[model samples]
Target: MAARKKWYSQGLRFSCTGCGYCCSGRPGYVYVNDEEIAQISQYLGLETAEFLSRFTRETHRERSLNERPNGDCVFLDPISRSCRIYPLRPRQCRTFPFWNSNLRRPRDWEDVCRTCPGCGKGPVFSYETIEELRRVIDL
Candidate 1:
């Protein structure tokens, strides 16, 4: 019989280095569900409707946070490279590189790690832990 492979059998570690590399570069959507929008709105002390209108935009049937003209996220502070709503950031933002797409293959993760200093460099996550984080991605 062969031993089964665990989710992160190779062992993965990650910690944000605060370089803000993930928050900028290339235009992308940060999808936020209604509950997330409400949390963020409460964090910012705004009503749900106001927060949605002021900080997000609709695309087809989905809603995502707006971005600066240069592609940086609206919540990212350019000068300090810090998220204004760090605690209440969207689910996608909270999950970081743990998204299934990046974890699907070793090469894919390496590709993402190239610029993200935090990807391969911090606390090692157990398979269970990694799976939990992956599960919440876009949820």
Candidate 2:
């Protein structure tokens, strides 16, 4: 008997090598939602309002996570090359190259892929995971 092909085998694949390159330097906007904000605040042991005031900035009327003066994410631990708030990270961070709503064209992903070696190659995610991301981001 032949095994059924995975959804990823039809199309789409990505594996995060955990290089941390994508989490470094001023790359692009990292949008956050209210629920995510609350989760991160709780994770940091801070009040939701306090966390937002301390770690986020308003841009174009939207709240975005703050970046360090050197351009890295505020939550990025330089020594570990990992996100201190990984578990509570926002949906934007959760959904990367698979941001279907923002990925209207291949060019939209070029810059991201250029900075992230993990892009365009890696693990094959199930369609369920992709759909979950879409739901999380309201895409």
Point to the candidate with the largest TM-score.
1
Models 1 onward score TM values of 0.90, 0.76
Q: What are the clashing pairs of model 2?
A: 14-123, 15-122, 15-123
Total clashes in model 2, counting residue pairs 3 or more apart in sequence or in different chains: 3
- Give the Cα-based TM-score of candidate 2 against the true structure: 0.76
Per-residue lDDT tens digits for candidate 2, residues 1-139, read 9976533444456788777776777556688877888889989999988998999988775788998877888889989889999887787777776776534555755656777787778776666776566566643
Misplaced by over 4 Å in model 2 are: 1-9, 107-111, 126-135
Which candidate should be chosen as best, given lDDT against the real structure? 1
* Clash list (residue pairs), candidate 1: none
All candidates: CA RMSD (Å): 2.2, 5.4
User: What is candidate 1's local distance difference test score?
Assistant: 0.86
